[model samples]
Target chain A: MNIVIIDYGAGNTKSVQFACHRLGFSPVLSNDKDVIRLADKVIFPGVGQASNAMQMLKKSGLDSVIPTLTQPVLGICLGMQLLCNTTEEGHTQGLGVFDVAVKRFSNTLKVPQMGWNTIFSLESNLFLGLKNDAYMYLVHSYYAEICEHTISQTNYGLNYSSALKRDNFYGVQFHPEKSSTEGAQILNNFLTL
Target chain B: MLTKRIIPCLDIKDGRTVKGVNFINLIDAGDPVVLAKEYAEKGADELVFLDISATLEGRKTTLEMVLKVAEQVNIPFTVGGGISSIKDVDSLLKSGADKVSINSSAIKRPELINELSAKFGSQCVVVAIDAKQIDGQWMVHLAGGSIPTELNLFNWAKEVEMRGAGEILFTSMDHDGTKDGFANEALSRLSTELHIPIIASGGAGTIQHFVDTFQIGKSDAALAASVFHFGEIKIHELKENLRKNNINVRL
Candidate 1:
């Protein structure tokens, strides 16, 4: 499969590519529009501030290309957050693929809810063969609220959308690549989707 | 629920794992990548690689080790030790490290915290504070707890959080290497006062100590070196013990 991980200067793309490599696939890392469009599966990964990432995306015109992709595109972490309508981080507008607005976790809990958390209420093939309340590694301050596109739910201080799906575009708040075996399974499921 | 984390810290020197690791079924015990993969399979929530290399060549080898570990290990890992600038962090993260922990550099120039957090998002910047109690005052220390600073622990931690540190890895030098227990009093205070997650390091001899750090210290994660390195406490068994203690662990 011609797998391309969109690299718009956002961090963690190497880890994502290595994850795909460990799964026996050598995924390409590219920011070019045509290279991404020609991929059988596309992985969009980001791990920095939202507004800065959005700016980078807009600079490369990927903000427009990403929303128009017909292949199964999996957005991980900040990549996932950028797919939403908007995010509270930096008051940035997103690519508007999921139709859900991302909100920051209240200060009552840790700002960036780090470490392993259980993700449940799985409703998509992305989590196929995964158990309920499966632990996925998450590190983010902003989360998309539960919506019609939400495929799974996770509780930090409250129930929020951990995974969202809207046709070809799927987003996960957790890093399936860094989430160990079960996470690898989810990545495989997405690749095979 | 967000479960508590059990982190096995690997100290690297000249591209080799320092302090003997006693894990069985290993051709090379000093190989950080192999040990990292073993720990991940054994149920370690996360891993921390502290580069204790003294020379420039050693540091370069440490970076290569980071790349190797990142490629082989599936779980999240942090690379720390002598990381001072955005350039250093950028290379490490680009090499596939999930996070970079800064110590003395952050203390020397507190703005480094703000700068790192601003550039790399708070989630990727971990401010590791090594402090010890001196004359009933918790004072921050530099150079692996050999040099002392007048800055108070709680005050420094508060500043770190305000400066946008995603997490604080607090190591009580007094409790570190003792295996007595974590500094739960100071740790609980840090957790209560700071909104960011606190990772309790040092003083981890027993599984119960792990339990105490999470329940009493209110630590989001616990990091230890000797017990895990010497294979005195197995990650899988330790987690089971934590689970039995009603503590939320990954298991």
Candidate 2:
């Protein structure tokens, strides 16, 4: 499979690539429009501030190219947040893929809800073999509020959309690549999609 | 609910895994990649690699070790111990380290925390403070708990949070390597004072210690070395026990 991981200077792409490598797939890391456009599967991974990442995406002209792709695209972490309508982080605008808004976690809880949390209310094939309340590694300060596109919910202080799906695009707030076996299964499901 | 984390810290020297009792008398454990894979499979929530290598060549090998571990291990790991600049963090994160923990560097120049959190995002910046109680006061120490500083543990932790640190890994030098328990009093205080997650390090010998650190210490995570490295406490069994105690864990 010609899997391409969209890399626009976002961190954690190496770990994502390594995850794919462990799953017996040699995924390519590319930011070129044509390379990403022709991939059998596209994995968009991000870690860092949202506005800065959106800026990088715009600079590479990928901000526009990403929304138009017809293949199965999986956006992980900040990549998922950038697929929403807008985010509270830096008041950054997103690609409008998921039709949701990202809001910062209230100060009552830790700003960045780090460590392992359970993802449940699974509503998509992305969670095919996964059980309800399966643990996934999450590290994010901003989360997409539950919306019509939300396919999974995780509770930190409240129920938030941990995974979303709209047509061909899928977004997960957790890092499946670093989420051990169940997470690898999610990535494999995305690949086989 | 977000579960309390069980982190098995591996002290690295010259590309090998080593464990020190009270930060001294290092003993070789095994190949880092092999040990990391074992810990991850055994249900370790996360891992911290503290590179104690003093020579330049050893540091270079540490980078290579990070790369290999990232390639093989399917869990998140943090690379720390002598990271002092953005350039160093950049290389380590690029090499696939999930986060970089800054110690003496952040103490010497507090701006380094702000700079790292701004550039890499606070989620990837972890400030590890090593402090021991001195005459009824928890005093911050530098250079792996050898050099003393006037900064109080609570005051420094608050500043770390204000500077935009995503988490604080507080190690009680007094309790470390004693196999008694964590400094729950100090840990709970830091957890209550700071809004970010606090990782309780140093004192961890039994499963109850892990439970106490989570329940009493109010720590989001607990990190230990000898107990786990020497096979005294098993990650899976410990997590199971924590779950039985009504404490949420990844197990």
Candidate 3:
């Protein structure tokens, strides 16, 4: 399978590639639209500022290419946030793949809500075979509010959309690559889809 | 709310897991990959690999071990010990480590933290501070707690946070390997003072110690080595105890 990892100059693609290799798949890290479009699966993984990431994507013209993907595409962390209509991280606009906006966690609790948290309300095949409320790792200051496309929800000060799905596009706010066994299982599930 | 974390630290030397008493009298623990996999399966929230090797050759072996462990384990892994520059951090992270921790080097050049956090978000930079109490003040130590610096623990912690470190891994040289308890007083102070997460390290002997560190120390995570390596404390039972204690730990 040609699993392409969207590499838009973010410094967080190594682990994602390793995750793919561990799951018995060789992933190609590329910014080329043709390669990404032709792949069996594309993973948009990132852990950086949205404004700069969007700028890079725009400069490479990947901003237009990403939304056109018909194959199963998974967006992780900042990549997930970039799939929304807008984000508060850098006052930047997103691809609008899902009808939602990313907002910063309220100051009432610790920001960046990092560490292992449980995911409930599992509704998609992405969580196939996994127990409900399985622990997955997360680290971010902004979160996507629950929306019509949300397939799973997690609570950290407030319940937010931990996972979202719109047709062939899927997104997870957590870092499944860094998350343990169940996380690896989720990646396998995505691959099977 | 995010659940409290239970991190098992593995001190590696010559590519083998090792444990020491108060930073002395080292003994072989086990294979890091095996132990790490067991810890993750038993519900360890994360794993920290600290290379305590003294020679340059040994550090290279540690990197290879990191590659092996990363290929097998699926948990978030942090690699520490002798990380001096961005190149070192790059190699380790590229080798599949989720985070790179720096200690004495970060102290010598505080800007290293800024540079690292700039290149690879603060989430990837973990500044580890090995501290010891001297003259009624908790002072930062260097070279694995052998050399004392003028920097105070609390002051250095705040400085690291300001410098863009994502988290601070505070190890009490006085409390490490003592098996009595953690430095909750200092851990609590560090927690209340810093905005970022504080990982309380050293002196975790019992399940009650874990409870106290989370409750009294107000630590975001608690890390221990010997008790876990020696099998004196099981990860599942410890987490069960924490859950029973009303602490929100992932089971």
Candidate 4:
């Protein structure tokens, strides 16, 4: 299947693209709207700040095209944040796919909940073989608050959205590509979607 | 909740891993990729590839090597050494690196942080501070700990955060490779001061050391080496221990 990775100029798409290649799925990396519309699956992965990422999406005119996707779309890290209503990183707007705002982790705890954190799985096709509390790799400071569309939850100092799914759009705050064998299994699950 | 991390750092020289005690000794560890994968399975929360040969050997500047190791394992990785500009940062991000850590280059050009953060975002930029406990003060060192900067650890850390770095990767040169246990007091102070996650590196000998670091140091994550490379603590076992300690690990 053709997995399309959105090149919004803000994410670590190479690793995700390479992971898809290793998983026997060929990914076409492009910011082109026509190419994205032709793909069977879409993956939006990012590592940079939130505001600039949104600006890049707007500049490329991909922001308007993103929310219109009918195929299964996965947003990783910053990609997930961009799919939210707003982000605290730069007070920038999001794609508004999910009506949630990304807030910064309180300084009372660590900023970026780095390293491996557990995702409490709920009823969702994104986590098929995964157990109830499966560990996933997370590397971010800003988090999306609990919303109606949340499919999984994780805690740093308090509860936050770990995964969000609505319609054909799915968003994960952690990098599935960096989450070990569990990550590979996640990619496999994402592929079946 | 997340378990505390234990990372192993590999300083690559001419494509081979190099080790040093107190940022000295500079002994050979093994091939960077093999040693990295070993540390990942053993107990490393993350792996750091610092290319010590780029300026000297005229090599690939650690990007391709990072990509090679990244392709092998599904773990978050950081690449340092000879990273000088926005172009370098972009290239490394495109090379599949989760984070790009800056040391002397950042010290020389603080604006680099702002620029990279503007484009790639702060999470992609990890400011690495190599410091030594000198005269009862944590003094920041530059150029692979070969030169000491005028900035103090606390001050520089605050500045780096203000300048838009997502996390601080602090390595105590004095305690590095000594396996004497981390400088918990110093780490604790920095963690209290910085709003970002502080990754403590250097001076880790056993599992008890990891425990003490979390209890005393209160660091968000811990990075180590020899203990992991020598088949000491497995990453899953370490997470289990952290979980058993009621540390709120992801079980």
CAPRI-wise, candidate 1 is high
**Which tens-of-lDDT digit does each residue in B1-251 have in candidate 3?**
58999998888997888764232222323678877777778889999999989998998899899988888888898999889989999889878788889999999999999999877788888899999999899999999899999999999999999998989899999999799999999999999988888899999999999999999999999999888776788889999999999999988
User: Residue-wise lDDT of candidate 4 within A42-159, one digit each (tens)?
Assistant: 9988776777788889999999999999999999988998999988887988999999999988878766667788888466888988887788888888899998999999888889
Clashes of 4: 7
For B158-220, candidate 1 gives per-residue lDDT tens digits of 999999899999999999989999999999999999899999998998988988988899999
TM-score of model number 2: 0.97
Error of 3 at B99 (Å): 0.8
Whose TM-score is higher: candidate 1's or candidate 3's?
Answer: 1
TM-score of chain B of 2: 0.95
Worst 10 residues of 2 chain B by lDDT: B20-29
Best of the candidates, TM-score: 1
Better of 2 and 3 by DockQ: 2
Residue A35, candidate 3: alpha-carbon lDDT: 93
Instruction: Give me the runs in candidate 2 sitting further than 4 Å from their true place.
Output: B20-29
Interface RMSD of 3: 1.6
| lDDT measured at residue B164 in model 4 versus the true structure, 0 to 100 | 88
Question: Compared with the true structure, what per-residue lDDT tens digits does model 2 show for residues B28-87?
Answer: 236888778878898999999999999989999999999999999989999999999999
Q: Against the hidden reference, what TM-scores do the models get?
A: 0.99, 0.97, 0.94, 0.92
The Cα local distance difference test for each model comes to 0.93, 0.93, 0.89, 0.81
What lDDT does candidate 3 reach at residue A49? 76
